[model samples]
Target chain A: MPLLDWARTQWDRALGALAVLIGAILLLVGWMKISDTGFVSEQLPYLASAGLGGVFLLGLGGMLWLSADLRDQWRELRGIRARLDATADLAE
Target chain B: MGILLGMARLHRKAGAAVCAVLGLAIVPLISADAQADATYAAVAEATGTRVILTNQSIPLNVAPQLQGPTASAVQNSLQQSDAYAAFPYPGEEVAGIPGVVGGAAGVPLPAYPFVIATSFGDGAKQLSYPGIELRAESTETLTQSTATGGSTGAGGTSSARVARDGDDVVAKAVTDLDALRIGESLVISGLHAVATASRDSAGKLTRASELSFTRLSAPGFVIGLTNGKFTLQNGTEAPAQNDVPLAQIAAALSGAGYPTTFQVPQETPDGIIGAGLQIQTTLPAPPAGTPGGFSGETPVTYTIGLLRAEVAYTVLPTTPAAADTGVDAGVDAATGVPGAPALPTTDLAGLPGTVPVLAPVAAPVAGIDLASLQASRAAVGSDVGWIYLMVAAVGLAAVGGCAVLYRGAR
Candidate 1:
């Protein structure tokens, strides 16, 4: 049971990290899709600025969603670990 | 598990690859800036070279000039050669043309041999040549013997007349009515011999019918293919190799494995003439690593205004006024008829001595140096090939990403 709880905790952390990375990737792709040929036409200065904004927003959205998953997974892992610990103590 | 490491490397490379591609894009842009002017100049230079090379040839035309002495002399020689049937004038026809008065019965080489005795004479100059005549020729020799008082031999009409002399006929020169000079003897070989017993009303010595024609043929005329040029109607040769500064542009194209045929459009002082070189090729797909049998015909085309440029030519000989005239009447009647004035009696028929030439080449000039322009265009194609490489880099990146995710999961 303890092993099971440990495994769940690891899974939760991994999934949480994955979700953050995936969200970041999705946002990057979405922003790039919207940039269009105009971004290049205006030259590097305008392009660089556009890239900064897009990247920032995408990163924020990604982190925000990942944090939410982390929170939920952490709660579930805590519940599992607590029940497992209590059972272990009673067994002893 | 090692694939995870590879994926990481691959991902990074993919990012770098995109940067590299974007970097390369600047290459064409930069090269274009640096080489555009030079390339076009090269094209023009090459074109000019081609034109000059083709145009500088010494034209070929047979010029004929006989002085008063030579003319009369030739006329006398014709009269003496028993090989020819007599006519009042050298060019007068025996049968006679309805309206045209000049021309005569053909005597094969009898008249053509005059060229040997009187080609270029005093007081004659240039002949506007279609081209020069080829020389694979023959000549005539005089034959006869002096008979003492040959003037009154056996016949009332000049005694030089003999009954028979075995295949050897003689030209008895009648210097005047009473005086006679024996010319050299002419051994008539390979001549068809015919005999006819002439019978008057009683069939007595009405006289052996006498009159024979010898068949004659001369080597056909040949025209050279030296430095052929395609001339356009606008009086300009298309695709001047050196239009600007690029010399050896055509040679360069040849080096690049381009087929020798291409077209170039040219803008002359008058207007634009499209010109181009065309390389015809035959490619056969055979078994792996083997070349197949192939044949090809490659010709370049150049269009300048109304005229086109390409190599062409024709050959022909002057027609004899009569069948025995030894003139080749119909040779290159197709290339286009030349405005030639007929000679009075000789194979030296037309005054131009050249066939009517219409080498209006089929090719029109395309804009400029074709090979060089093509080279630059190829540069563009190469740039595109690089873009495809970038696409490949992206594919590798995607695969790397998948590998990374899989490994991380493990």
Candidate 2:
């Protein structure tokens, strides 16, 4: 099955994963602000390049997660519609 | 009585005959011994030798007239040639003067290697240190500079003395000596062993020794005076632009080698100045034609550029005991040959008032030590720009890691 179809049946797992990831993001941001605040000015050139490189990597990962989450919802809704039609047929 | 007289006469006649025979027998042995000595003396005269140590030649007459063995039979006769004692001169008594004890004095008032000095104002009236020689692995004049201040009032104490800055100081020095064993290893052709060296009774170098070179890089800083203005040499007319900044000079020096920038700073009264050249450890070739003549010429080329030097210092006079108020510019006191053109001095004519100014050289970093551009990189301080950049990169990595984790959980 497509990964999106699989995620549709695993709502609890996806939400749990997202919560852990957000926590990690907050922790890393705090560490950077605390460890090297002066890095913003003194090494601006290097900091900008590194920041852009980091953002690209993160955006890619987030995009993959978002794509998988949407695909799962679509698969789950289709599965519900098919089951509902089968029930209606039994009723008739 | 007649019988006794006859017996005594007979004994005297017999004793006389025996003495005559003994004298004849000794004559041949004595003649043979004399013959042997004559032959050995001829051989020793032929074999004994002496060696030359300088421009002087050795006299060939010290061999003894006696000889024994043609080889080992001849006694080894050797003498120090005339060159051994010819280098006597009277000027070696002062400090830092180099040469044979009695030889012609080397360049006068010889300053030792690795020295640093700072001088300011007309006649170094503001401040100076006499002997601030710093002996280390290497030394160089990173910059020579001058700067002027806007005076608050004419003849006021503030306007009277030209405040000396470190950028106005000049210095140059050499750290290495090139020792050549060429002269020390005498090459001769007459002896059985070809060219051989002579050693003293203690088996040390008694004859010619290796040639060694002493490098003296003289960085010039003559103070000029005009009105109430003072400046280190900037080779220019404007007092405002006379100063050579130190930070820029240091960066250039630490990157290149010695710097040759002599910018005459403007003194209050005079605006223009011409700089004398300094070529230390100069090696002049035969000029493509002649064989020898230790003459002088402008062998090095002078370069110009804006000097930058960052001078970090404790107070010029931190302690009285540690201060050097008397400057013995050793050159003038030397005896034989004259010292280098009285190391460009400070002008006293326009020196404002009777301030009793002493141009004692303080440890001023010069910008004109550009004698060798090869070693400049090592002379400057360390740069830590890359380290700062790395720290910033790590900060960015944290941001990336956060994004990765957030996406993975989602």
Candidate 3:
């Protein structure tokens, strides 16, 4: 149960990090391809595909990371609600 | 059923992974080396005032003359028989073919056609080149010729003459202007520019370009340029521009009550209403070990008014580089020459060139001058600001994403 709880909380963050790392690597490779090539025509495909793909991965990683923050905020809101319910019961 | 349900839950991550892999794979596959779609050994072109223009673009190497079936037959006979052994006389011959009299020796060798000559000049009085007073002219003559050849003991000797205009290599282009009205307040006159190259008998290559103008004038203003020239010897490379003339032109404009702004030439999306001059000469290298041979195409171009020349060397798989939008980029209101400031004086002077402007000049209506009207119209021209702003927004979002991602990593 403890291991499951830890995995549940850290999964998004871990995946986000992996995605960011892969995206950065892709960007570096794309830049190297651009600088290594002689002709502008030869660089076009790599620029369009690798460049855009890296950007897409980076965006996805950022979104997933932000979602973790929102998930934590939601948990805090639930705790606050439960405490309010407990106070109301005690009053009753 | 359980596997399918699990796959559905992880579909987003699965899709992202597939896209990343596909994106990485596609780069190498699609970017395989493509052979050059087109190739040119040399190209030369020039333009000025739209009317005086010239282009001399010779395609890749070609044999000077064609050897059709007859020539081929002669070559075949020479190779097959003893035509190389003895000189064949007209009356007496007994060779490989039974009926053949003189053998291959009697057939006159093809004339060595080794010269290309092109010339252009404006003849009509049409207002094609507005600023030009004298007729625009451009000429290029290149010659590579062999005089005579004789076969001796299984080999042959031929005499070649590299005579460009007779053993000389020469390229010449000229565009001149008498007067031009850039805007309501500015008039330029007596402009002459020439791009020329010639090789002397001693094998010395000389390139000479000249630029001069009488004055840039308006109602109460006038300015003159010191002559501009660029001359070099025996080299394939030349300076990019005739900087002396350009600097003198700028100096003259600045002196004649105009702003001192020297702007680089750029391809403007919406063309400018102005006059410009450009001339280029490219000469091919002589064939190796051929004495007295001038081998190259000579092209001459002339223009007046506005001109645009674009030479794309390769067929790009994607769209070419972006041209200047001329939007939100500060430009002179009347002339549309970017970076040139608006003229302060509003005096509308009559065009004072040899070639007259026949159309009756339009008077300023409702107290608005032509320059101001031009500026207002330019303001309403296509705006590329939104596109740039969108790019900027995306850039900012990427920065924000980086910040968030960095913090999460930490």
Candidate 4:
């Protein structure tokens, strides 16, 4: 499936990736602004705001993506537990 | 199946490492500033060995050379001094008067009783009798191959001073003053010219040639105003204009009628008399058909002025300190130098006065120093509250996103 179509089905993962993309763009723009500046004082603000903010959004997106993965693993484990219980009942 | 999973995990790690390396590489692309662009343009304009700084480990080193108005203005003033130093006195050879440290003296023959100071540069400087005073000062960047060298050194200052004291005429030109070097190569060629003449009250010329020259040498071949001869390669001189002769001054002072007897140097002296005039000889050919007088790369034409004088008068000081005053002051500092005008910081599209390049990956930022950075930061007192605020906001957003993910998974 096209990534966009898959993302529509998996909205959680899509939002996480979108946030990461925005954060990366913000970081790049901030870096561009800092490069044109001469003084550390001039660059510090960009580093703090955009730089830190971008990192923050990245971490958030990673966590959200990780949570979706864990949820998938939990669903798989629950199906296995149900099947094992049904077999136990048949043996009994 | 377990082995396949382990191989897939290794591949993912390798892919992440590659992505990290690519992200780091993007830093250099964002580091281009206006000065770098200007320096790149200048190098592209000049013809010679195309120096490319590819090996980031090996730093390219070049002795900084003066750029902009200060250097050219000083050169112009020195050229005028050469004219005076080369002035032909009937009985005496005007030797040592137009060299590195000697001044160029003697008013042009026609402009008797009234001294005329002629300099071919930007803006016309005129001096009238009975308080004749003329002073010009300018500053220009001592730009190196900034694109390759990756840094520009401090600027140089040049000044021209012309003053008349009774029967005495004094003109001085001092260039490459207060020059500073950034890199290892210390190549500085400074020119000083001072011409002073004293005559007895009786009006008969007593002393006409008073000159001194100072020369500082580095290890390599230096090209500048050497022995009153300016070598021009790949450049052409602008014709001299606005010469105020004694007749014009006499007409202007006709009503005032200051009766003063002035001795005119002989109009025509034996030998070539093109002093005080600059010429542009054809490239790769001997100057005026004389053999072995010029040397420079092809396609780079430098104008040679015949005149040599050393008058030190600062017109506009556009050094970093002076530049901090305002944009107008910095632009106005380009009052000298015909072709080489001062580079105005205002044209950098609202960037900081000096748009120093960020260090490429592992190197220090090319032009900006630690002391200046700290000083600038302390002076500006940048408000970083927005940074903290954004961090907090993002942190809260991440927590909320995490909660939503957990509920969806459940």
Error of 4 at B382 (Å): 14
Best-to-worst order by lDDT is 3, 4, 1, 2
Which number leads on lDDT?
3
For candidate 3 chain B, the 10 contiguous residues with the lowest summed lDDT are B68-77
Q: Fnat of the models, one by one?
A: 0.00, 0.01, 0.02, 0.07
**Of the pair 1 and 4, which is ahead by lDDT?**
4
Instruction: Give per-residue CA lDDT, model 3, range B1-410, as digits (tens).
Output: 35434633353354345346534643542354322111000111222232111122223321121110000000000011000101111111112233343335675444222211212222111111121111111222221111111222211111111113322333333334455454345654556544343333222334444444555454443444433332221122232332345555445544554433322222222211123332222234446554544444432221232211111111112212112111222545565423311212111123332122221111111111334433433442222222222332342255355444544643
Q: Candidate 2 i-RMS (Å)?
A: 52.1
TM-score of chain B of each: 0.14, 0.17, 0.24, 0.20
Sort the candidates on TM-score, descending order.
4, 3, 2, 1
Score residue B323 of candidate 1 by CA lDDT.
30
Estimate, for each residue in B196-270, the C-alpha lDDT of model 2 and write its tens digit: 112121111111111111111113332232221233434333334364354443333323333322233221111
Per TM-score, the best of the predicted structures is 4
Model-by-model DockQ, in order: 0.01, 0.01, 0.04, 0.07
lDDT for B368 (candidate 3): 14
Note the Cα lDDT for every prediction shown.
Answer: 0.24, 0.23, 0.33, 0.30
Query: Which model, 1 or 2, shows the larger TM-score?
Result: 2
Candidates 2 and 4: which is better by TM-score?
4
The TM-score, computed over Cα atoms with residue i paired to residue i, of candidate 2 is 0.21
Candidate ranking under DockQ, highest first, comes to 4, 3, 1, 2
* CAPRI tier for the interface of model 1: incorrect
> What TM value does the first chain of each candidate achieve?
0.44, 0.49, 0.85, 0.82
Alpha carbon lDDT at A11, candidate 1 = 60
Candidate 4 lDDT over B1-410, as tens digits, reads: 35534633543453344335435534443343211100000000010011112122223431111121111122211112101111011111212223323334443332222222223232343333332222222212111111111112333222323332321223333322223221133222232322222111121122121111122122232223333333321122221233335343333322232211111211111001111211111224324534433323222111111111221111123223223222121121233311211221111122332112111111110111323322332343322333433453454455445545544654
